[model samples]
Every structure is written in C-alpha cells, then in structure tokens.
Target: EAAVTQSPRNKVAVTGGKVTLSCNQTNNHNNMYWYRQDTGHGLRLIHYSYGAGSTEKGDIPDGYKASRPSQENFSLILELATPSQTSVYFCASGDLGGPNQDTQYFGPGTRLLVL
Candidate 1:
C-alpha cells in the first residue's frame, strides 16, 4: 500500500517567519509531490521529486520550495512566510505510475495559518 504521512498536521506562523512541513512515505515510491489546497483552486502542485537528491518546481512554487534527501522523505520549506501562503498542504506518492498516476495517495493534510 502507498502510505504518506505529514508532520505538524496544523501550524500557525507569523509573517516573515519560516515554516517547514515534513513528509515521510514507506511505499518507497519513485515519485512524490507537495501541493496546497485552497477554496476554488483545488490542489495545486508546489514541487515534486523523482527520487532522492532531486527536486523540481511545480505550478505554484513561488512561495514554497521542496527537498528530497532520500527515497522515503520529502520536505516543503516556506521562506519568509506570508498570510497568502496560508492553506492546507498535502503530500502524495506514487509508484512507477503513468496514466494511472491519478491513483496517488495523499496524506491527511496540513493546515497552515500565517498570522
């Protein structure tokens, strides 16, 4: 089974503060992604990595960045956070997927609030 877990399920931060969201997967998947979900916008990808030691920007990578130091872990970094960045973030993973990539499994979610 594909399992993804995210840390600090909820967070509160101040403007200009730094926040880090962590994700860990036991599926040992080759592909992992970080996305933010907001009203009307659906889930938009922030970053993704194919495997360890690699990372790539996604549609909404402006205020966020990602790191994949190993096959089982990925982290999202928010630098100088802003209220605009406040939203529910999700982490997902897939194993050698193609057309069925839609089967990616998501973590519960991380609600981030910037005060």
Candidate 2:
C-alpha cells in the first residue's frame, strides 16, 4: 500500500515568517507532488520531483520551494509566509501518468493558517 505522511498536521505562522512542511512516502513511486487546496481555487500543484536529488516547478512555485532528498522523502519550504498562503497542503506520490499511473494517493494534509 502507498503511504504518505506529513509532519505538523497543523501550523500557525506569522506573516513574513517561514514555514516548512515535510512529507515522506513509502510507495517508491517515481513522481511526488505538493499541492494546496483552498475554497475557490481548489487544489493547485505547487511543486513536484521526478526522483531523488531532482525537483521541478509545478503550476505555482512562487513563494514555495521543494526538496527531494531521497525517493522516500520530500519537503516543501515556504520562505516567507503570508495570509494568502494559508491553506491545506497535501503530498502525493504516483507513477508518472500514462496507463501505468493509477491514482495519486495523498497524505492526510497539513492545515496552515498565516496571520
């Protein structure tokens, strides 16, 4: 079974401060992604990594950074937190889409509130 875990299930950050969200997956999937979910915008991909030691910018990479140290670990770094950045963050891992990619399994998610 694919398992994704995130640290600090909840977070409260001050504006201009830094918030780092960490994720780990034991699925051994090739592609891992970070996404944020809000009321209107829904889920937006922030960053993704194809494999260890490699990262890629996703749909919205501004104000956010990602690191993949190994196939089992991925981290999302928020350099400067803002109220607008408050949302639920999720980490997912799956095979690179085609016919092989089943479905991206997501973590429980981290709810971040920036004040």
Candidate 3:
C-alpha cells in the first residue's frame, strides 16, 4: 500500500513570510503530488514529481515551488505567503500505470493560516 505523510499538521504564517511544508512517503511509488483544498476551489494540484530529483509544476503552481531530492521526500515552498494561500494542503502518492495508473492516496492534511 502507498503511505504518504505530511508535517506540521497546522501552520500559521505572516503575510510575505516564507513557509515550507514537508512530505514523506514510505511507498516506493514513482509519483508524488501536492494539492491544496479550499472551500469551493476543490483540490488543486500545486506540484508533483515523477521520481527523485524531478519536480514538475502542476495546475496551480504559481506562488508555490516544490523539491524532490529523494524518492521518499518532497517539499513545498512558499516564498512569500499570502492570505490567499491559506488553505488545507495534502500530500499524496501513487504509482503511475500505463493508461490506467490514477489511484491517489492523500495524507490527513495540513491547515495553513496566513495573516
């Protein structure tokens, strides 16, 4: 089974401050993703990586950056936090299959508050 976990279940940041969220996966899956869940926006992908040392931008990559230094770790970086960035962040992991690999499992979530 795939297992992904995130740090600092909750966070509070001042506007314009830098915030970093970390993720770690025990599964050896090749795909790792970061998503933010908001009231009406739903879960929007912020970044993802196929494998170690490979970070790719996702649907809502603006105002966010990602790092994947190893297969077991991924990090999301917010250089200048904003009120608009306050949301619930989730880390997910799954193996990419050929034409059918789309199962994604999510972590509990990290609530970020920007003031």
Candidate 4:
C-alpha cells in the first residue's frame, strides 16, 4: 500500500508571513502533486513534479512554490502567505503507468489559517 504523510497538520500564520507545507511518500511514485481544497473552488492544483529536481507550475501557481528534493519528499512553500491562500492543502503521489496508473494516493491534509 502507498504511504504518505504531512507535517504540521494544522497551522496559524499572519498575513505576509512565510509558511511551508511538507509531504513525504514511500511509494516511490514518479509524479507528485500539491493541491489546495477550498469550499467552492474545490481541489485546485498548485504545483507538481515529474520527479526529483523537476517542478512544474499548475493552474494556481501564482502564490506558491514547490520542491521535490528526493523521491520521497515534496514541499509546498508560501513565501508571503495571505488570507486568501488559507485552505486545506493536500499532497499526492502517483506513477505514469501500472494498474494504478490514474490513481493517486494522498496524504491526510494540512489546514492553514492566515490571519
């Protein structure tokens, strides 16, 4: 089974402060993604990586940065967090091919509050 974990399950930050959300996966999947889940907008992709040393911008990459330092680690960075950026963030890992090709295993989630 795929295993994924996130740090600081909940957080509180001030406006314009820096915040970082981290994720780690033991599945060794080649693709990793960062997303934010909001009430109306739903799950919106923030960033993703094909593998280590590769970070690609997603639909809503304006205020966030992503890093994949190794096969098991991926991080989402908010240089200057804002109130509008507060939401539940998720991390997922998947492979390009296999029985679970289109399936992504996700972490529990990290809730952030920007005041």
Whose lDDT is greatest here?
4
Against the true structure, candidate 2 reaches a TM-score of 0.93
TM-score of each: 0.93, 0.93, 0.93, 0.97
Q: Candidate 4: misplaced stretches above 4 Å?
A: none
lDDT of 3 by residue, 9-85 (tens): 99999999999999998977799999999988899999999999999999999999999999999999999999999
Which ten contiguous residues of candidate 3 have the minimum total lDDT?
96-105
lDDT values of the candidates? 0.92, 0.93, 0.92, 0.94
TM-score of 1: 0.93
Estimate the TM-score for candidate 3. Answer: 0.93
Give the alpha carbon lDDT tens digit for every residue of 8-81 in model 4: 89999999999999999999899999999999899999999999999999999998999999999999999999
Candidate 3 lDDT for residue 109? 89
Candidate 2 residue runs with Cα over 4 Å from true position: 97-102
